[model samples]
Target: MAKRVLILSSSPRRGGNSDRLCDEFLRGAAEAGHQVEKIFLRDCTIHYCTGCGLCSREGRPCPQQDDAARIIEKMVCADVIVMASPVYFYTMSAQMKTLIDRSCARYYTEISGKEFYLLLTAAEPDRQLMLRTVDTFQGFFDCLEEAHLRRSILCPGVWNVGEIEGHAALQEACEAGRNC
Candidate 1:
């Protein structure tokens, strides 16, 4: 079965290792016959959440009303979501985190049940941080009745642009997408 997969590249740095990894993942997934679309965060205007709880009360959605909502609509319709980002300060980049925060409407409405995966690169070369981040995602998806984590690929120490081109993990990510 062909699945609709959305790849959200939340790295503000273009052509960075994280973006490269996301490209690999999308290639792999597409080769597997899944429909894939990638939305680069750097190209969009995504504002941070204000904790207004507006989504809960009136379904006002994110107040920013920028391109993030458009991406969120795609996310709601996707069968799988791949969030690709670089770890900053032991967490996901601000760009990605803000997108996640703005996704409160999905939670409040419980309108979609979708699988999610994380593709991350970091400078610290620590695997635990990646695992913890994936765990955080796990908790978020726990609300969906049939949601399941597909995968989380963390390629640490990829601190430079295009540095992940020849990495074995990059190839693995591609293959994973192909098989997805």
Candidate 2:
């Protein structure tokens, strides 16, 4: 069976390590016959969450009238949501974090039961911190009715474009994608 997979890539550099990982993952998914869509956050205009809570209260749905809401809609439509970002200061990029914060409406209604995968790359290779970041997703995503976290790929010590060219784990990431 083919699944619709949406990948939100937050890397600003083209063909960067994070981008390469995403490409590998998508390639595996495509080879498995799944439909995949990758959205680059750097090219999109998305604002940070204002904490207005209007999306949860008045149903305003993301006060920032930019591309954030549309992206969320794509996320809702997909069977799997893969967030690929380069970690900054031991956390996800601001672009990725902002999009997640702005997706409050989905927390309650839209994508309540959707599956999610996280792909994080960092300059420092620390499995413990990367696992912690993956765990942080639980706070916002665990409440969904039937949400399942299939995998979280943390490719560390990659800070340049093409740095992951010959990394062995990249193959594992592709395999992970096939299973998605």
Candidate 3:
């Protein structure tokens, strides 16, 4: 039952807290014999969705020529999708949101039945601070029929880059991936 796992790391900062957790999750997933790939949004050229409605209108391809479509293709083929982001202003990063928006072309049909894992990090210590962020992810999940949220790791109080170097949540993230 090896799953094709895709980890989308949407941290603007390279090696940021959330990205670190993503790495740990990747490591654990790999150790557990899952086929894993981690895509860093910072390295991808994903443009913002313009709501042009072309994607939804005719089931046509997105007019914007960017990496978003390719990423969506990967998501469509993945059995498990892990979206990791640094909580920005109580929500997922713009990169993650934009990617989700751009998936309008095939989300309902192609992105169905996938297991999702949410990994988020924030400066706020209270886990409740991430509720809004979780809700944001849930909004996308709700659209994809049978796309269940399998797990969520909220690592709070880590703001600066590399701050999660020794955080215990890193291990928790790894364990989550291992158990996946």
Candidate 4:
């Protein structure tokens, strides 16, 4: 059966290491006959999630109108979700964090039972140190019922633009998507 794959690229820098990994993953997923969509969060008007209680009330809607609603809708419908981010300060990017925070709207309702792939690129050289960053993404999954962290690719020491070119992590990402 074909699956719906949603790749969320949260790198503010266009064509950044993590962004390129997302493309490779998309390529492999598409080649495998899956319906794949890659959304660059930098290009989307995703506002910071206001701590409003409207979504908690029945029949009340969120007031801050932005692209988060649409993005969350796609996340809810996706069978597989790929979240890619360039690690700054040893964590996911601000864009990715915003999206995760905005997901509070449907976290308790529909953000469940999905497979996730976490892709991260960091200037830090230690893989274990990068795992600390991956922990942030994993923490989100821990909150979701039946959320499966199917795979992850950590490209460490990739600070400069195009530093990740020809890196084996790209192939790993593609293989993970192909095997998805």
Give the per-residue lDDT digits (tens) of candidate 3, residues 35-107: 9999999899988888888878877788888898899999999999999998888888999988888888664
What lDDT tens digits, residue by residue, belong to model 4 across residues 12-122? 988989999999999999999999999999999988878776776654666778999999999999999999998888888999999988888774468889999999999
Task: Tell me which of candidates 1 and 4 scores higher on lDDT.
Answer: 4
Off by over 4 Å in 3: none
TM-score of 2: 0.91
Q: Each model's TM-score? A: 0.89, 0.91, 0.96, 0.96
Over 35-101, each residue of candidate 2 has an lDDT whose tens digit, in order, gives 9999989899988778887777787756577898889889889999888878777667788888878
* TM-score pick, better of 2 and 4: 4
Worst 10 residues of 2 by lDDT: 105-114
Looking at candidate 4, the ten consecutive residues that score lowest on lDDT are 53-62
1-180: candidate 1 lDDT, tens digit per residue: 999989989888888898888898898888889999998988998887788887867867556768877877888888888888787776677887787777786562452567777888887677776776666666656755677677788887677788777888788779878877
Error of 3 at 47 (Å): 1.2
lDDT winner between candidates 2 and 4: 4
Judged by whole-model lDDT over C-alpha atoms, candidate 4 comes out at 0.90
* True-structure RMSD, every candidate: 2.0, 1.7, 1.0, 1.1
Cα deviation of 59, candidate 3, in Å: 1.8
C-alpha lDDT of all candidate models, in order = 0.79, 0.81, 0.90, 0.90
Give the Å error, residue 34, model 3.
Answer: 0.7
Error in Å for residue 29 of model 1? 1.8
Model 2, global lDDT:
0.81
The segments of candidate 4 whose C-alpha lies over 4 angstroms from its true place after superposition are none
